[model samples]
Target chain A: MIIDINAFLGHYPFRRLPHNSARTMIELMDAHGIDSAVVSSLHSVFYRDAHRGNEDLFLETKDFGSRFVRVATVNPKYVSWRRDLDEAMDRWKMKAVTLFPAHHGYLLSDVECQQAIEEIVRRDIPLVLTQRLEDRRQRHHWDAAEDLEFKSVLELVRQHTKLRLALVNWIGLDGKRMAEAGLQGRCLIDFARLHVLLNKDVDKLISSLGITSIAFGTHMPFDYVGPSLVKLANLESNPAIDYPAVSWRNAARFFGLEGGD
Target chain B: MRKIDVHNHVFDAVDQPGANWARVESMIEAAEWLGIETLCCSRPITGGAMAEIAEVRRANDAVLATMQRYPDRVRGFCFIQPGNGRLAIDEMQRCFDQGMIGVKLYNQFKYADPMVYPIAEKCIELRIPLLGHSAHLTDARSIAAQPMTSDSLEFCKLATRFPELILILGHINGGGDWEWAIKGLRECENVYLDTSGSVLENDTIEMCVRELGVKRILFATDQTMEGCVGKILSAQLSSEQREDIFWKNAHAIFARRTS
Candidate 1:
């Protein structure tokens, strides 16, 4: 039950990588033993229309069976956001939504935005928020993050009470601090971009978070899967916590795939 | 036999640029074939201005995924842009609180840049080592291209500024920088070097062996994208030095840092 928790489809304008079809990505995932992936669309975020990417990603995941779950990147701030969400679920059949606050340019705490988040939570669809992409020093756009106020994101999550967030792009240091701050119980952090420090810390992190707050991810189509999976496969975690169940089971439960085989 | 890797990187696989899952898998398959106990990968480090915080955070998301993927075999470093002190600290606290052991800095940015002082000070106060690039004998031309020596000096300055912090200078070979680094960094007891990159000049290793002793040196591969076998075997110091550099020194540092 290996799950690649973090993934994107379509063309990303910032990175000059060729876009691979979802079928090709699935083949690649199969080769790496990734049983499932939570996918978003790169083109949608770039164009400020997650629907385009969400439509393609939804069609792609439906064909992949349970191996791929459609996690559409949504921008609630859009006036047509209600139609967008309905179409994404009804038309695309997606079970999750990934919101890019910085790229989408709407504070999570916005009144309308908070209402939308509540609606998504009411639907029981997982909401994954992509925090940031690059270190501030290395951003392709110098001022891309200047207007980003993460407090709004955190506060929104706290306010929702029932909102369970799947945070992507959480680095080593920040992820740990979030765990220490007790964000893990309510928010699951997908380790899609972590690399540094000691291997033992992985077990420690999982243990600290009680496994339920953890999920496996590989930022695929940008980087390869070998190192991504190897980081986990190489750890010497206790056998009980080191199983695929810990990797995929918790994620399956979080995303409402509890009965998934 | 707990092994620690202080540097690494992970990118989004869904929108891959260079190699895909197969490429990275085979590479790791090869590493596993060679018996590397563990390796830590970082969120991808893209070179650019400090204003690219969002991009950095995106890269960091991938890093978080990697750490969660292999909790036993790998750990992750929070690659930070020193320009946003407040945000960077928030990220450091976030990742560190999540159980990350330290932070990483690329030489593309300076160690002594005024923007970075706050970050260094925080790491020192928190007792997390800032793993960064450094060279001993640097070529001025390559220095312009990479700025290894200047960054190394600034690393020393960082140690001087925050005496309790541990600054691990990555890569002790492929140039004469390690040789010169010993002189500049020796006075700062908190400063240490990780034996990585190309093989060190035996004389340089010997000098470090006698002067700084093995305790000041550590064994690292800097081989995130490369094979780790060669780098692991590259620690050509004596068995005693090997003990300290390969495992003991890291354990000591980890113990203190973790506490």
Candidate 2:
């Protein structure tokens, strides 16, 4: 079963963009052979902080049952961080948390930020950090979302050695230099953009980094499902290496769902 | 799904950069996924006078290498760098001798850029088709920054001089920049619209197919920066229109091989 780790659930800035409803999103996922997804809300990333998005996520996941896994998005800079996170954890039963450092404008190395990360790690929930959602070249609505500060992320990972950080939107070209600099296995990465790299090249990266380091992600509403599905189907390599593990097995293990198989 | 990708690139093994090889392999994998057949041109051919003859030769060799690496999946064009008419003629002759199919020109430079005219004339003389980039230079903002407008007009003039030569105005889908080129080529029987480039919302193909016939529209994917075959399939065209645009017309143009 494929699990999309990069999926989103809330109304984004796309007030005019044609998109699938929650029900249609499930249908499209099924159409593309994706069985389950771990989703967050863009609204949570934008306004009312992660607390509000987490509330909406709980509501949305209710209809999908186990098909939709909830990830609470929190603003490290928010004043009510501890209270909001405690409520999200005790009430909503969230398994993971996503951080929007760029949107929230908080450095990963901020002392207060480290406290928040510590709280999330203390709860044994995986932390997902989204880099950027759209291509910078595309016409944008505003200047808020820009290129992510990779150095800050690297530093954060180095400081919190035991934290299970999920870097969503991993790519073949961009993060390779860091991987060479000893950043390979510590963070769990989503494979939404890896579709751009296929065949023997994909095999090389997989052999070097175990399947557990990967996570399948759809980057829904922004990216079309066809390209990602087409690439995954045609990926060339040893069957075991190219098999669906990054998004499915990795998330399953991280979320304590051994019965996902 | 028999399909033709109008835009692509290849480089010589000896001269090709490592990153470029990786990019090409990735692109080939992408093409295989969509069951596409692609026509690859050399960087020298696409980049025009900016390329040297030796570099063009290496690029030609690279295109030959890519064709060899993926047999039956790739076709090629004899790229002519600007200002080298003698070399362009020599390259055209070599292409024919080496079994290359057509010609490609980046028509974004000065229309009458002295170096380009000879190649245009040579293409006409050789009876080979040339795919030209056409964007409008309505003002200076896009002109100095882009390589699209005036060159298309020059290409049209050459096409008028040689009626038998097949000239395709590429990226008709490129908004405003090439709108005039599209309008100008509508009256030219020998000139066709190669539907390729950017993810534009405006429906250029519909207008081309309506004003000109389906026979005049050729499907192309600028695969380096875009998805080659998937883009062709993604177009908001009818199945019949897509079928003709994607395969039939291209097959008819490069008719020698069994692609």
For model 2 chain B, the run of ten residues with the poorest summed lDDT: B224-233
The lowest-lDDT stretch of 10 consecutive residues in candidate 2 chain A is A134-143
Q: Which prediction has the highest DockQ against the true structure?
A: 2
Interface RMSD of each: 12.7, 6.4
lDDT of 2 at A231: 46
lDDT of 2 at A42: 76
Candidate 2 residue A46 C-alpha distance from true site, Å: 3.4
Docking class of 2: incorrect
Clashes of each: 90, 12
For candidate 1, what is the lDDT?
0.63
Worst 10 residues of 1 chain B by lDDT: B226-235
Chain A accuracy of model 2 expressed as TM-score: 0.87
Listed per prediction, chain B TM-scores read 0.82, 0.82
Candidate 1 residue lDDT tens string, B91-195: 888878777777887654677777778888888777777787665433344445554334356677777887788888776653444545666776777788765
In terms of TM-score, which candidate is strongest?
2
Q: Tens digits of per-residue lDDT for model 2 on B1-259? A: 6778765666435335553577567667767756676654544444324666776677677777676667677777877666564876797778767766777766535544656667667666665677766665444434445554443566567667767677777666553344455567666777777766543322345567777788888877665223234334444468888889988887787763323
